[model samples]
Target: MFCGGYQVQGTIFLNPNCDPMMDAQLIGGALQGFGCDKDVLIDILTQRSSAQRIMIAEAYGSLYGRNLLEDLRENLDGHFKEVMVGLMYSPPAYDAHELWHAMKGAGTDENCLIDILASRTTSDIFQLKEVYLMQYGNNLDQDIYSETSGHFRDALINLAQGVREEGYADPGMAAQDAMVLWEACQRRTGEHKNMMQMMLCNKSHQQLWMVFQEFQNISGQDIATAIEECYDGYFQQLLLAIVSCVRDKPSYFAYRLYSAIHDFGFHNKTIIRTIVARSEIDLFTIRQRYKERYGKSLFHDLKNFASGHYEKALLAICASDGQDF
Candidate 1:
């Protein structure tokens, strides 16, 4: 999601509600500010959608607002800079490619690979793979295999392939996949752990939800129990989060915000990146759904779960209700 919604709907919606003309003016104003301010950049570009960023880029020349890309070139640094600049100029696909390049060859930059690959939508990953090959002359899986090792590599590769298409899958076929998942979970079988990793990262929320529902009914045990029975560490938590999210997404964010604050003991950089990426899109609905389901707002939960500046930023994002049109 974009910059999490703010305290005021008036500021977020304004008159234009992402009016490109207004976006153009805002970009110029920021670029021409007293000096390059990162706070300004994060404040403006982080909040605006890609279409608005494009308009600002296009109008920059006429307005002499400093070419958006050039300004970013001058101002930003490191991985955030790369992701933001790529997002500013092109679609999300190229940023995924940038992430791939950072990881591929030699020792493999696991951090970069996980950062982009872990949180993307299936369609986004699909498009990323297509563009990655076009840009790099190699497949994503091949590059991953070259860099990674063991079951972790295998699992990561499967996920990067985007094999779990979310829609129009035959329920019959999906039942079979669910059976495979369930049997893997059976303590007698011992296939549960590896399968857990595969499912958690690979399955889409919709496809996996079907699997989760049937597995619980058929196995007579809930999905969380199955996951707890099978896996551990961040991956287990991720699977649990997935199941929780399928039941209700806002609950998932609440859990995540809680884990970030109280459970994990801090705002992990990975969680931060993931939340920032998502807050622009699904987060608004997640907040609404959280309120509807929990009878307490997502923002309120963050206030309880987190503290300090971290709390302030996340709470602001929650209040903004990032999903609003």
Candidate 2:
């Protein structure tokens, strides 16, 4: 089953039988009576399921008279802190936090915006909006409006509304939408921006995947290729993100991990966010896809890019067996 863009098989399922109170005690002990036991923090936080983590948080608060999140924040520093805290948040809250940060800076992080907003389902967006509001005290759509503009802004706004079509896809409608996409993108000298955005934003992922197939058959061009040819800048990026997410989100995120890790500059923020966000969702499948496509272990690459506590923490979460890497 698809949880928005993430596949169920892609998730890391651990802590099947767990004691949250015991976990809370252990975690509390790790944080106290030492100069912050990094190993214990890495092991416990990264091994447990997200649900278990929530329980641990509650137990930690009751047991220690301190919030688990605040204790982790004080004990850990740098990227290690980031990954641990990210794991503690519910999925929607995490996404909201990410979006808030993306738009908080002087210049908007278009890639972050596109990566998140375009790929999520209507239901995912609805949940995200609620969390975003609670976390940031601003509407998600209004934040988008403030941070972005033009066709790209419009697409983001449409996605933020969380009003996309859901349920079974119609083959006939898929074909018709494909033609509509082709005409909007390929035939005209100047692309029909409104029509393209409307259809792409409105259609369900199932329908969009079929539309992409029909588009490939009709235009002899993959949807991403066509979008690349017709549009430029953030608009093209968003369109490609939508198509990629619809067709294969794991592959899409796998490529993202590859780019972030392989580059000299090393998009650390993107790397940390992607791994932490997708850890419970599809990081395993992403790891498999990454290995298959790149002919290297993501774990090996991770070591090259990060080190010490940060590397240890990241590898712990990423390990297939939920062991420290």
Q: Best TM-score goes to which candidate?
A: 2
Model 2 agreement with the true structure over 25-138: per-residue lDDT tens digits: 888888886588788777778888878899999999998788999888898888888988998998889899999999996998888898888877777899989999988899
lDDT value for model 1? 0.58
The CA lDDT at 290 in model 1 is 50
Candidate number achieving the greatest lDDT relative to the actual structure = 2
Error of 2 at 177 (Å): 1.0
153-265 in candidate 1: lDDT tens per residue?
Answer: 66667677776655533566566777877777765233555666677666666676677777877888887897787766544554565466446554555455545545556
lDDT of 2 at 97: 91
Which runs in model 1 stand beyond 4 Å of their true positions? 1-29, 32-34, 37-47, 61-67, 76-119, 131-139, 146-148, 169-178, 187-207, 233-250, 289-325
lDDT, model 2, position 99: 95
Residue 123, candidate 2: alpha-carbon lDDT: 79
TM-scores of all candidate predictions against the true structure: 0.66, 0.93
How displaced is residue 148 in candidate 2, in Å? 0.7
Candidate 2, residue 217: Cα displacement in angstroms equals: 2.3
Sliding window of 10 residues with minimal summed lDDT for model 2:
3-12
